[model samples]
Target: MQSNHTEKMSSLGLSAWYGEKQALVNVSISMKANSVTAIIGPSGCGKSTYIRCLNRMHELVPKATVTGQVLLDKEDIYGPGVDPVMIRRRVGMVFQKPNPFPTMSIYDNVAAGLKLTGMRRGKSLDDIVKSSLEQAGLWDEVKYDLKKPGTSVSGGQQQRLCIARAIALQPEVILMDEPCSALDPVATAKIEGLMASLKEKYTVVVVTHNMQQASRVADFTAFLYLGKLIEYDETTKIFENPKEDLTERYITGKFG
Candidate 1:
């Protein structure tokens, strides 16, 4: 079924390579505004590479090259004269592991990006930090402990802190690459719970190996294999009645 929502981001014939090896092959998919889209595939299927390409992060690696276009709201992000740093600001990323800046406090970690961009210490910055933490669903837990080291938090809280850091930037799109992989079930559930509220403000794309996680959080799901997009559809349809044989096989545990 066709979706009525506006397309917030999309890739047109996007392909990527690392030195001599190609990691992605002509992958094209659209992510809708204010929704969560999940990229699911086995290891080595280029799920991470694909989302990395969305925000131009893939090119940060040496010898990494890309072809085609990544569009955010119909503008090609790879267009000449476009600043990649700005693209990254507009499309934030969260990694598999919680990686709060070790030397900074939780408050400082969330404020780091803003400060680097020349936002000075002030009430506005303070409000942004508190609001971001609240948006990440972490304000009450650590409101009184903001002075503590960012790395001092539990793995789960640290991840949420990282999310708050990303949220502080007010990005238009948020990309999570296996964000819950390192967390315990309780922590994973909390992160998963945050997804619904997050989509109300930022477009979210998550790369997850856990099919259950994808099924639980995503509005749309894309199944990839061998660096190719096999199917992209609504989450329910993808899980309950996928179109491609490869997708069916993988979803059914026949093979990855």
Candidate 2:
């Protein structure tokens, strides 16, 4: 579905392509402003690819290419003079696994994104670092040891640190690719709660292998199969009364 560019944070259309092989096929969806949208599907279904395409990341691969428009606030991200770095700054990403900068302290890790955008040496930087960590819900745990290496934190803390890093730049949209897949149950729960709170301020697009996680945190859910979006609807409707039989079967623990 083509999005109303005027008000949408992100939108995609008939967007598909490949290295001489088509992966996504005319997939279209509009991400709402300041809401959580979860993409769920079996492996190799192009869930990850779809997210990457949002910031013009798919073309980063040597042999990959895509056609169709992906807009951010009505401006085509691929338009001439649009820098990928600038696009990414507006659209932050958190990977499946926690990836903290090993050499940096927790404070520095959170401030890393700001440094990339050229914010350095001031109260502004310090305030952003602290506030970002607080927003990620990690400040209470690590505030005392801001100097500690990020790798010294536990798995869950490390993930939150990564989130803090993303938020420091104040991106309008945050893309999370299976962010909780690496954490234990308790850690996963914390991240889900964080997601819930984050939507109040930032638009979040998440990809998840865990169906329950999708059900728990998503305001909207989109199901994909073979790179095609099969169903996109309110999370409750999609979970409780999916329009597509494939979605129902998958949610019921049948073959993914």
Error of 1 at 149 (Å): 0.4
Question: Per-residue CA lDDT of candidate 1, range 99-217, in tens?
Answer: 99999999999998898877444569889999999999999999999999999999999999999999998899999999999999999999999987899899999999999999999
In terms of lDDT, the best-performing candidate is: 1
Clashes of each: 0, 1
Off by over 4 Å in 1: 1-4, 119-123
- Most accurate candidate by TM-score: 1
> Where does model 2 exceed 4 Å of error?
1-7, 120-123
TM-score of each: 0.97, 0.93
Model 1 gets an lDDT of: 0.94
Please provide, for model 2 over 1-256, each residue's C-alpha lDDT reduced to its tens digit, 9 standing for 90 to 100.
Answer: 3231224555566465677777788788888876789999999889998998887777888888887778888888878898988899889899998999999999989988877679554568888888899999999999999999999999999999999999998888999999999999999999999999998888899999898999999988999889899999989999999999999998998873
